[model samples]
Target: MAKKVALLQGNEACAHGALYAGCSFFGGYPITPSTEVAEVLSGELPKIGGKFIQMEDEIGAMASVIGASLTGAKALTATSGPGVSLKQELIGYACIAETPCVIINVMRGGPSTGMPTGPGQSDVMQAMWGTHGDHAAIALVPASCQEIFSETVRAFNLAEKYRMPVQVLYDEIVGHMREPVEFPEPGELEVIDRTAPSVGPEAYKPYDTSFGDVPPLAAFGSGYKYHVTGLNKAEDGFPTTKADLVDAEERRQISKVKNPTALADIESNEEYLTEDAEVIIWAYGSTARSSRYAVNELRKEGIKAGLFRPITLWPFPEKRTAELAKQAKAIVVPEMNLGQMILEVERVAMGACKIAGVHRVDGEPINPGQIIAQVKEVL
Candidate 1:
């Protein structure tokens, strides 16, 4: 098969990822860095008989996508920092209701509309714990345009397979940068459609634990009718005040999604000058790109340094990192946020190896030369 190379931006690749993932609907409000995703989807969805709507605001955009998912469509929405904060309530609703959908947050610096065009990974903690109640959520971070394309497909698969809302966490650098990416031809991949109940309406239970941890979803227009609401309820989708039932409902919501072996896992790209070296550089997202360049420069100077890139930001790759920590002399973590993911690196390292953080949150990326200097100091 001949490969076709198209120079594409990260946001456009994300739109293509949704189409390939069987996303038939998109609802979003335009915001910088992330606006391109909504713009591209608005144009592409219609050609494939999919639907696109620009809602009045971010909350409406989030609410609408969840509603569409009830009709058995794989749905999506995109936003930046401020918009992501606006949608947290409905995001919680999607979590409790086990709605299958994808939310792409192309992050920018901010507490409230910080910088529209600049890059920042400030939303890392929010992506995992932003919603009101205690619930398990998965967020996938992509560093490059290729990863944006591939991880978007995985985002949909995780959402539908487990019947939950999943996030694709992209920074501004990846959202706007242009790169070459290859698209899979039709029928080269597997898509998981939401499982529907085989039984009649009377026998159907909304949270049917007997079948599997996941209950089969019944579409709204389907004759097998069911009710869905935000209130804490039992398996049949009805509101209940019973204490134990509410406890059971909440526990299942988290446990079913939080199992690291079952749901959360990490992806990484590493180089092994560490086999004989003392220092290691741990980074991800756009920072990983810089670190990659820095590591090669270190090698040129006869410095033994290795790079460890985490593709799965959440669940934080504890097992692999613990093993890497034992062998290295020192670990350096560089991120756009001030000491966010660095805490995880320290926890897993357990003082067995010296760990230091190189972080900046002023909306500028860390320089590769600065990273190379940090590596040389440790060596």
Candidate 2:
């Protein structure tokens, strides 16, 4: 049978993708470039018997998601830059408690309401370090409307599989632009739910690492009652002040996604003609679209230019990037902000390649000409 397809804005695709992933609850406060996600879900969730709530603020919205997720609801929330800032404290709570919830952050200009309707990739670093702690982070950056749909689904899977908060961020240009999205049939795309504890309520601990670093998460009121807290916890779920236990717990949480095995599954990127290229364009989100155009133009002129787009921003794609840095003589990074992701590219390149950046934070999208010019100068 032919797949059902539609012209969808990135935000609408995200809403439908969440539904496809069996998301049962959405708790969010409306914010520019992302409000459509809430609007679409508002009318659709009830028809499917799912719950949708608009909280008084971003913090409340995020808090509601973590709370509902505790009850095993495949919960999600949507917001932009400012809202994300407000949600950071609770995001930290979700991380430490090991809650599985998805956050859709439509990228807009920032530093406190910089540009509600403009595109910005400045939040790239915030997604990893915004919560203020030594915890693991999984952030997906999709460059198109169709990818936003599929990556939203992938975001939920990673959140559940890793038993933590996962973020999906796309620029406002991608979020509001319309494109055709082919919907995946039932069972076509992989859907992962949090593992359930096999042990009965009599023998369940929320942070039981004996089952592995990522232990099964039992839903609240599902015949399993376990303590959930923001404080450092032992395997039994109670707060631990012991230095050894605290140190071990912290290490375990970060190692869950930082280790080589975990990084292999969490890191994703795209390489276009990078094998023989002398200059590589490193971009993500909407800036990648322009970089692709620049690469083609440069190739037509007989220049060795390629594009390396990072789909999973966090986990950094360090190893592959280091390889690219060695293979290419120069790396050009174009982003919607003043050198946000360029920092990551530079750190990984470690002076192995000539690195340059094309930055724009003045409420404007970075164009192909800008990327092309930067690539030329770096070469």
Candidate 3:
């Protein structure tokens, strides 16, 4: 039998999820709608023999996570809109150094603290392209409390597997709302550890591309002393001024995630009302929750409407959207942002179907009725 517990808020579940994901280090600064995540983790991490630090600001927090990750620890941090902005540069540094770290951004209204406590899905594109330069990124959006936990673990796995930074993008509603969650047994899931080189210290190169661009990582005090920096460098960890070496390093950094088949781990619930009908509705995150209810209601009214949701926000899952678009006559994209995700949807749709973007940025979710109306209009 499944255990039934009281509803758990998304932030609490996120902290618990990080704990379950074997996170031993947390460095963060508190901000609205996301503070609970840092608070819960702070209390629980120490009890489980983990370390938690409340840094002076978000930049220090991000730097601390990268440092902890290089030491071979599964590390994480949680913050909100403005804090996320502060960490972008260090985020790029982590990308260059190939640090395995998880960043949870419980998003509120953005463009610099636009609304501290209000809900918003405005961080979609920023979470994907916020860091400077070209680098591989994976952003997972959780629509409910259950995903808060699952996605946090997924963030860790991806970070470690790719040896890169992964973001679990959360909206204020999902971060603060309460819902039931059942955690699975620990051993049932596969955990990917960082690849450590077995070569002798004298023969090892920390950034050797031959090892699938992932060299065995040596810790700071592991006796195989090496240098790590944000600058372009060679496999031996020395800074290089060569253009070819710079291009090679940048490409290698991106290819690790781009080349991996796990890039498009999309989760969507679609109805085939459109298999015979004319219109499709696309939405995600909190808005998708409401859009789902609306789609069902539309079906009840004999309207042929279906839904498309993206679990993996980054990488955009363009292929799936393209496939769905090819089969439909019209498409509706509802998002909390002012067309941020919708732009991607349109790009992926490839103009195969008639498409329009429905968006809201008034610190509220794009409700169900609005989506149904949009679907009807498109039809």
Which candidate should be chosen as best, given lDDT against the real structure? 2
lDDT of 3 by residue, 1-379 (tens): 6654557899999998888789999999989989998898888888988899999999999999999988878999999878889999999998888889999989888799799988888888888889889987788887899888888887898888778898998888899999988876776555667887788778888788887765667766676777898888898888998989898888878766666365543232434355665677877778878878888899999887887767777767767788888988888888778888778878888889999878888988788889888888877
Query: Model 3, which residues run further than 4 Å from truth?
Result: 1-6, 264-277
Q: What is the lDDT of residue 292 in candidate 1?
A: 81
lDDT of 2 by residue, 96-181 (tens): 99999999999898799887989999998999998888888999999999999999999999999999999999989999999999
Against the true structure, what is each candidate's TM-score?
0.94, 0.99, 0.95
Better of 1 and 2 by TM-score: 2
Ranking by lDDT: 2, 1, 3
User: What's the TM for model 3?
Assistant: 0.95
Q: What lDDT tens digits, residue by residue, belong to model 1 across residues 257-337?
A: 666556433343445465765678888888888888888888888877788887777656777788878988888888888
- Candidate 3 global CA lDDT score: 0.83
Q: CA lDDT, every prediction?
A: 0.85, 0.92, 0.83
Please report how far candidate 3 places residue 135 from its true position, in Å.
1.4
